[model samples]
Target chain A: MKEIWTITRRELQAYFDSLMAYILLILFLGFSGFFTWIYGSDIFFVKQANLQVFFSIAYWTLFFFIPALTMRLLSEENRSGTIELLLTKPISEWQVIVAKFLAALLLIVAALALTTPYYITVSSLGNIDNGAVFSGYLALILVSGMYIAIGLFTSSITNNQIVAYLLALSIGIFFQIIFQMLSSNLTGIAGGVTDYLSINSHFESMTRGVIDSRDLIYFLSVIVLGLVFSESMLMKKRSV
Target chain B: MDIVIENMTKTYGRQKAVDNISLQVKTGEILGFLGPNGAGKTTTMKAITSFLIPDSGKIFIGNISVNDNPQEAKKNIGYLPENNPLYEDMPVIDYLQFCARIEGIAKDKINDKVREVIQTCGISREKHKKISELSKGYKQRVGLAQALIHDPEVLILDEPTTGLDPNQIIEIRELIKKIGKEKTVILSSHILAEVEATCDRIVIIKKGKIVADGTVEELRSQAQGNETLKVTIEDGGLDEIFKALQLLNTVELVDFVDKSTQTFQVKSKPGQSSRRDVFNLCVEKGWTLTQLTFIETRLEDIFYELTLDN
Candidate 1:
């Protein structure tokens, strides 16, 4: 645990030192805040005190931002040959991967935390659905976790950051929209399977204050698979 | 701790990087690894550090098998890889602290340990600077400091002095020798003089296999079996002097090195010395013996002879 924290702390410091974290936070907040407060279909337009507007905007904002945050997590290390230096220490490969994962997740959480004024202001204006607000935040966190995993897996496979970003976006698109489209155009078991694979289906349910075990299982399983694939990629580098 | 490798072999695709090689480094010994490019020196060091697993065989660091428990085995090792890769964006102090923390140093002692290594590596002046802003020599020193922070039982340095100036190389070599007094040190370099100056034992490899392993003197004598002498005599015909030197029982072959100077080169039989016989012959012929110097076989010649043709 200490080893993981040590690496995670260094990674977070690097993110901030390079101004990557600040740029990401600013862009994320700018885009989400604009669409949720002043743009079309904002909270005032809906005439509801619920934070559905913010959650929906954040969902799309994080989808684009998470890949940018994670693109350099492993790819830069691989490119710089620092992976050898890190691995030779008294730490396992899993610890390194987990540390990077936590670093990116913590940065995303910080970005989400910065927008808490939105929640407070909405509650001040009218009676908000507290349960729905809590679940909406939970849904964003879960989706961010899944996308971060996929980004890390792509980063682990290649030493080029651009390649990692593109690959991650390609993989994320299927979960974000392709599955939803395929499910609507199909029928029977195939449609049900596509719907299950669509992250939007799971994310929308959680936003509506529904936290089913199936939804949790779906998100957690994707995160685990991504982490497992990243670990395997790291191990494969040793033999090659 | 002592490092032991038993018949380790690692291949990348169809090419063998390390081909069934075995070696041992006792504590307090500095073993210099010498080889050409792609000759498996780096591959062997990587295996010892648990960075690369061998296709067949095992490595043990103080009785702990690397394949079975790499984390435990790695605790005893401090490796400075070939290129000395580091996080260029990090400050020298912060990077050392991170290395110390990862080595499982006590939280309170991390600061002190990082300071000690910084002082030891002579990077105290640049500790606060970002690694990318430092010069190459300073960067190399930082890499050394990171490796020495935990003061592991074994130190593996691959081409540690490759890019340093002459003075910096000497300083680093002295530091390595000072540290090797208690730790098992394995350093690889193609610089023959550096190896001869620092290592207690030398191992030379070619094409993924060890071609020679011994002390400098041992390799010298092993490569040169017979004694040779360049003799300069006066008041005697060069051809006659050569004939007289060759006729001696100890001398195997003799040739006129310089006819004008009356210099003759003589080669003795295996394990034989022709100096006394040649001197006696000169006295018997009433020729003045001006110079008789032994020709020592150089390390370069030995390395070339061993590494050539394979």
Candidate 2:
């Protein structure tokens, strides 16, 4: 556990040590704010009491941002041959994977925290659905974790960060929309299966001011599967 | 603790990167691993450090089996890999501290340990700079420092002196010798002279197999090559002596050394005393021999003979 945290700390420090963290934060906030407040069909246009515009815009922004953030977590280490130095230490592959995952999660949390003024401004304007707002943020956290996991897994697959990012985005597209697309077009058992598996279905349920154990399990399962896949890739590298 | 390996082998696809090979390094001995490119030197080192899992056999570090207990085995080893990859964005001190942390040193002792390692590696002046900003030699020193931060019993340094200038190489060599005084050191290099200068015992591997293992003198004595003799006769009537010298089958090649002194280099078959035969011939020919010297067969000849065999 100590080793894991130490790795996490270093990984997090690396993000801030370079211009990547600042650039990512600025881009995320800029795009999300522009779409939610300054662009067409924003909160003012909808005249809604909650932050559905912000959540919707932020979710899409995070979809692209998380991969860029997580791309370097393992890929850079592999490219620089630091992974050899890291694995030779007294730490397991799983510990390294978990540490990388936690570091990306922490960065997402920081980005979310920076958007607090949006919540404050919306609440001050009119009556808002506090329950729905909390659930929305929580759902964002879960979705961020899912994308980060996929990014990490892709990063472990190759030493190229761009390839990792693209791979993560490609794999994530299936969960983000393909499943939803199939769910709407298919019927009966196939439709039900796709709807149950689609990340949007679970994300949608949480954004409506309700938390379900089933939705939590679905998100947690994807997280576990992605992390486990990343760990397996590392093990293969160690063997190779 | 000493390291032990038995029949360790690692294969990539159909090619065997590390063939079934076994060797041991006794405690407090500096073992130089000499090999050409793609000779499985790095693969074997990686196996010992637990960076790569061998396909078969086992590595034991101080009686701890690396295959069964890799983390524990890794704790006892400080490996400086071939390229010495480091976090370029990280400053020297932070990198050392990170190494110390992963090495399992106490949190409070990390500072002291990093300081001690910096002193040992002679990187104190550049400790404040980022790794990428430092010179190549300084970066190499940082690599050594990280390996020594935990003071592990075993140190596996691959190409430790590579990319360093002559002065820096000597400095690093002396440092390795000092470190090897108390720790078992296994260093790999293509430079035979450096290995001869620093290592107590030298092992040459080729194509994933141990071809030679012994001291410098032992390996040199085993080398089957021609002996070179620098012979200098009086400047007068040197052609007659040169002619008679080349008559003997033992003298393979003869070349002029100096026109003023009539110095001519002569080569003789292995285990044959060219001086005795040449002296008798000089006396018979009435040629006054001013100088007769023997050049020892070098490690280069031995390394080539052992590794370049078809």
Candidate 3:
């Protein structure tokens, strides 16, 4: 546990020390803000108190920004050969994976927190359901956690940052988009399984102002599975 | 207090990186691991450090089996890999402190241990600088400092002095010698002189197997079963001198260069010094004796002979 904390702190500090974090924040906030104020007003004709616009904009923004945030997490370590140093430490492989996961999760959480002004703005406009807004934030966290997990897993597979980014982006898009398309093609239990695997379906269900245990389980499973795969990859490499 | 490897092997696809190799290092001894490129030096070090698992056989650090309990075996080892990977953004001292924490040093003693190692590694002045900002030598020193922060019983360094200037190399060499006095050290290098200077006993590996393992003098004696005798004769015919020395039973090969200002190289039987025989030969040939020197076979010659294609 102590080793995890040590690695987490260093990773967090590294994010802030570089310009990547600031640039990601600006890009994310700028796009989210632009879509919410201008595009939201134009699309709905009369956007009084709806956060639907903000959620839509934020999700699309995260689709690209999260990959940029996580491309270097494990890839840079591999490139610099620091992975050997890290493995030689008196820490388990799971600790390293979990620490890096949490660090990336924290960066996304911080970026999401900066969007709080949109919440306050919507609340002041009209009779916006605070419950829906709160649930939407929860959904965002869960979805972002899943994305970060996938990004970390992709980062583990290669040493090139560009390759890591593209892999993460493709996997992210598949889970968020392609799985949703496949869910509709089947019926009954198989369709249910496909829907459960689709990240957008669960997140969309949660954002509709209801907290379902099934959605929580699906997202958590994805996070756990991604991390386990990363740990196993590291173990396999060390054995060879 | 000792590390024992029995028939350890690691094969990658069709190539054997570390073929069945066994060796031992006693406590508080510096064992130099010398091998040419692709001779399994790094593989052996990685296996010993528990960074890589061997395909067969066993490695025991004290009583813990490395293959069975890698984490336990790693606890007793402090490894400095060839690249010295470090977090470049963190300050030197901060990185060392992190290493100390991960090594499970007591919280109260972490700072003191970091300070001590920084001083011992001669990087006290660069402690506050970011690791990326430090020079290569200082960065290497920081790497060494982090490795020593936990004070493990055994130290494994893979090419620690590589890519350093001559002065820096000497300083790091001396530091390793000092540290080896208190811990078992397994240092790998391709340079025989560096090994001879720092290691108490040397193990030379070729083609993933132990070819020669002994002290400098022992390996030299084993490689060249002959002694080299250098004879310098003053202003005499080299052909006549060679003929006279070639007649001696102790001399196996004699090559005299230059007819005037005669200098001759003579090879004699093992454990034999033919200085007296050469002196008598020179006197008989009426050659004025100016200088006579005997050269012992060096570790370089032994290393080349063992690794070179016969």
Candidate 4:
């Protein structure tokens, strides 16, 4: 745990020490605010105090934002050759992976926390279901976690950050939108499998203001699978 | 701690980066690993440091297997890998502290330990600056400082002085020498003179195999298996010296070099000197001997002879 914290602390500091973090935070909040209030569906236009517009906009904003934030986690280290320096320490590969995951997750949480004013504004406007608002944020965190893991795995596979970003985005799109589209349009087992594979269906369920075990299991399973694949990719580098 | 490796080999798609090789470095020994550009020096160092796994070999640091319990073995080693990759965004002090923490140094002693290494590596002034803001020499010092903060029993440095100016190289070499008095150091360098001056023993590799291993003089003798001597004679005719040089049984070949000097390349039998016979011959011929110097086969010559063809 000490070793993992050592890595995590340094990585977290690195994120704040650079301009990337500030840029990401601004872009995430700016896009979320713009899409939710001005362009997509304003509270006045919807005639309700619900934050569904913000949550809906966040889904797309997070897709690009999470990948940008995570694409450099391992890929930059590999490109700069610091991965070798880091891995050769007494710490294990699993520890490095876990530390990086926690660091990126913390940054994402901070970004999400900054969006709290939107919820406060919605509450001030009219009566709003607090449970649904809480669930909406919870669903955002789960989906963001899933995407971050996928980004980390793709980052581990390649040393180029741009390549990692594109690869992760491509794979994430399959689960984010393609599967959702296919599942709704197709029928029978194919549609059922696509629906099960798509993360949006699970996220949609969570956004309905109730927590379900199946949706939680689905997100958790994706997180575990992504982390496991990332760990295996890093371990394979040791042999080759 | 002592490091022992046996039958270590690592291959990449049929190309062996580190072929079967065995070596041992006792405690407090400085082993200079010398090789050509692609001779697998980095690969071997990585395998020993637990950064890479060997295909068919075993590495033990203080009797703990590097292939098995790497965490325990890694605690004994501090490696400054080639290119000295560091977090450019981090301050030198923070980077060292990070390394000390990862190396499991006690929290209470982290500050003092970082101080000691910063002083030892002569990077105290640069400690507060970001790594990317420092010059190459100070960057290298930060690299060394990071490796030393834990005070590990073994230190592995790959091309530690590759890019430094003359003064910085000497400084780092002096630092390594001071540290080598207490720790086992395995450093690879293309600078033969630096290695010859600093390392107590050298292991020269070519094509992923060790071609030469010994002290400077021992390896020199092993390279040519004979000695060449340059004789500068004054007040003596070249023809007289040439004719008289053949009379000595120890003198193998005498070639006229210039007006009065001639180079006598000789192969002495074990534990014998051809100069003794040459001195006597000069005395007998009433010739004046101005200078006599042996042409020692340098590490550069041996490195080229071993690595040039392949």
| Local distance difference test, each candidate | 0.93, 0.91, 0.86, 0.88
Candidate 2 per-residue lDDT over residues A1-240, each given as its tens digit: 999999999998998988777888899899999988999999999998788888888888889899999999899999999999999998999999999999989988998999999999999999988999999999999999999999999999999999999999999999888999999999999999999988988888798888999999999999999999999999999787
Give the per-residue Cα lDDT of candidate 1 at B94: 92
**Window of ten residues with lowest summed lDDT in model 1 chain B:** B237-246
Model 3: which docking level applies? medium
Clashes of 3: 0
**Residue B137 of model 1, lDDT score:** 86
Measured with C-alpha atoms, the lDDT of residue A72 in candidate 3 is: 94
lDDT (tens digit, per residue) of candidate 3 on B285-308: 777888777678788888888888
Once fitted onto the true fold, the runs of candidate 2 whose alpha carbons sit more than 4 angstroms away are B224-228, B235-286
Candidate 4 chain B: 10-residue stretch with minimal lDDT: B260-269
lDDT by residue (tens digit), candidate 1, B101-140? 9999999999999989988999988989999999888889
TM-score of each: 0.97, 0.93, 0.95, 0.96
Tens digits of per-residue lDDT, candidate 2, B112-214, equal 9999999988998999999999998999999999888889999999999989999999999999999999999999999989999999999999989999999
Q: Model 1 segments beyond 4 Å from truth?
A: B233-236, B255-264, B283-291
Candidate 3 lDDT over residue span A1-107, tens digit each: 88898898888888888977788888888898887787645324555576777786788888888888788988899899999998988888899999999988888
Docking quality tier of candidate 4?
high
Q: Which candidate number maximizes TM-score?
A: 1
In model 3, the Cα lDDT at residue A194 comes to: 75
- Which residue pairs clash in candidate 2? none
TM-score of candidate 4 versus the correct structure, residues matched by position: 0.96
Q: Which lDDT value does model 4 have at B93? A: 89
Preferred candidate (TM-score higher): 2 or 3:
3
Better of 3 and 4 by DockQ: 4
Query: For residues A45-155, could you state the per-residue lDDT of candidate 4 as single tens digits?
Result: 897888888887888888988888889999999899999998888888889988998888888889989998998998999999999989988998889889989999999
